[model samples]
Target: MSYTLDRGDLADLARGAALLGTGGGGDPYIGRLLVDQALRHGPGTITVLDPDDLRDDDFVIPTAQMGAPTVMVEKIPRGDEAVAALRALEDHLGRRADATMPIECGGINSMIPLLVAARTGLPVVDADGMGRAFPELQMETFSVYGVPGSPLAVGGENGETVIIDTGADNRRMEWLARGIAVRLGGVAHIAEYAMSGADVRRTAVPRTLGLGLRIGRALRAARENHRDPVEALADTMAGTLYDKVRVLFRGKVVDVERRTEAGFARGHATIAAFDGPRTLELTFQNEHLVARAGGEVRCVVPDLICVLEADTGEPITTEGLRYGQRAVVVGISTPDLMRSPEALGVFGPRAFGLDMEFQPVEDLVPL
Candidate 1:
């Protein structure tokens, strides 16, 4: 069934998506603002559709943002970049998109599909290529499951556009797209991995937009009810596809070393426990990739590593982490869909150049 999303729902959806982004999808604040702009541009309400309802030949497009997310904090999109990219892709294919969906389920990328859907009057699919956010282009279930990442269309903030039909392996497409994205000003809105409905149903992660919305609702409800918001988050994750949540660490941000390089926010951070000398270290390439506590590997990709405000359980993006802020780091395992050997080879720890085993967050953290 399709449903209308109210203005009231944006906050929760963005909040949930930020948490799930694992620190790398672009800022949720900007994402929400973009959605607000999109709403103002055309439709006041977003219509969401189930993936199962899609017909075999329906044209489905996935929308996203690519480049150093840190750069977006200052260089806000012009609000029409993604829509322009979608139109460019449609023109290249000589077919209009029947529906659109997120390429990722994190931060701005999570909301990009809705923005396109709102402007185009197409229903957004309740699915995404990655169940959560990943920094790089090839690290999606769609790629792992045999989907080409082109003919991809990338659009700049000022209407500059490029139509990419690499149609090669996703890795080659990633480099080609990343290089183009960097040239477009370090942040570009994109439409890629155009798929037929049958292919999307087979390759995309199902119902993740709904999952993110639920996460937002759960956290907001818990906070309003004076319950522990982190606890509420755990309870919500308990019944989801990406179960096995762990309070990885609780501390104050003591250090963050970051730089905008290779069109990505590459960095590391250290959090010191307030009550003890113990510390947790995080290393990320756009998104949190590893969590080490006292020199031990507590969690690694493709599991999610999230830093949330201690009291409110609100997710803090990489740029938002600052000294002395109280924070809690949580880890959530990726679903089996992203854990198979084939999937692991694409996005697992080793894929990130980390020399370690791909252990589920549940095993690494222990119940």
Candidate 2:
């Protein structure tokens, strides 16, 4: 499904995107404000397209912000780095970008491509490289499925730009860009994973943008109707790619041990149940990677462990986790494409250094 994305869609879009982001994309509030500004002065509205809408030869590029989400909350973008990075990548590739897509479907990342489209009059594809957010640049289906991530551009707020045009592997591109992003003051806008429309249709996760919008609208409607917003979120998630959604834990944040290290936000969080001694332990590198309770792993990477405000069902970024806040943790299964043996090998448990096999979140019942 394709549609026009204007300011009216942003509030809910950001809400839903934050939930789908799994807590690692850039700040959703900041991203929403940027796109709102873009609509006010740039294109006024962005056209969103389905991946199948693209011609086989159309030039598609994915754009995102690379670095700590914690850093982004304090250092707002100058509103120019996205287009600057896009331009640099376009110049390196020797062609104009026909359309832009999100490397991952996360808060800020989902908005970044629209920010670019708002500034440049390009359409945004409805699909994304990852169905949800991940920390590393290489942890995306676009790259794991054989698309090169180099010939990419990274740009800073002070107008500095770097174009990495190379045949090196995706991990190497992530390594070089990550170091540069840290040097660029802990964050930078990037354009990478240049591919054709056919490649996108084959490799990208489809309709996530629409899914996000539906989720946002559902949450808002539930709130207006005085229903349980978290229940509404789970209902909205049903019949979609992430159908196996459930409320795994309901409690207040008891502890958060977070640190900004090596250009990523790495951390662990503990949530204690409201009425029991039960607790959920979360380990993450940018996005929430694993969830465990009473020594039983409830949800592992590749599946999603999303944390939301208990009352409002507002999604929280990893950087936003704090002690004493009431929260609800949801376990959602990923699309089949993301759970395949080959795909799991790239982003599954071992990829995040967890010593466990991948299990569907639904299978991990109460301990």
Candidate 3:
């Protein structure tokens, strides 16, 4: 059966995107708002195409935003940048993309593709390159299947556009892009990793858009029906249920030691957990990369570590993590994507400079 994405699906899309993000896609809220606005303004329809439905000759591209998520919230998208990015890419390739897909499912990147689709009058595939979010561009499933990430286009907020096809590796590509992103005020719109539709079908994570819709709906329903948000989340992800934890701390961030040299939002969040003489430490770069409970390792890379509202289990992005947040710490397991050796090699503890060996959350969690 064919699938069609509509306005009502945004909530599910957002929730599913968060789930797939494995606690790392920056906040899904902005993406939801952006996409919601785009749909309302243009009222375009996104037609879902099965992988087999795509033609071998059909031009396809996976697109997203590049920069600190914190920058995105403050800078706000010019609203034209996503479409502009696609146009810039089309101009370079001298070909129109028949379809577009999200590079990742959570945060701005997830919904940016929808806006791009509306603007370009192209249908968006009901899938993404990564089932969940990752820190680097090359970490996508597209990269796993040998797709090249460049000759890409980035659209700045001021209606300016830059194209780069650095011969360097992914890290270098990140360096070059981030240099421009910083110049653009830490946010930029980009359409990259061009490939044919057939290739996208093979490399992309299928049905994630639909899954996203399911999650959004579940979250909304839970809120309206006064159901347990955590249980709703568990149902959607098929995740194991854990006892809800209390707020360890809440306070204005007294200090944040941060560095963007890694092309990620590298920083530590020290919060006064609820009570006397106690605090929680969160280490992150882009996504929440690590968490500590009273300085003891509670979670690390390849696992999902998120800071949410103390009262509500809503996620807080790395960029969104601030001082003075009354927050609860939740550790969700990473999706199956990172379990693969290739995926692990890119984002495992070693990749994050940890001396400890990797352990799947399923193994570490109490059964």
Task: Give the better candidate number (1 or 2) by lDDT.
Answer: 2
lDDT of 1 at 297: 93
TM-score for each candidate, following the candidate numbering: 0.98, 0.98, 0.84
Model 3 ranges off by over 4 Å: 15-27, 50-52, 239-263, 270-280, 294-296, 322-326
Can you write out model 1's per-residue Cα lDDT over 137-249, one digit (the tens) per residue?
89999999988988889999878889877675788888888998889879998999899999988998888888899999988888788888878988888867887889899
Query: What's the number of clashes in each of the models?
Result: 0, 0, 16
TM-score of 1: 0.98
TM-score of model 2 (CA atoms): 0.98
Model 1 steric clash pairs = none
Q: Return the lDDT, model 1, position 260.
A: 95
lDDT of 2: 0.89
- The candidate 3 region of ten consecutive residues with least summed lDDT is 240-249
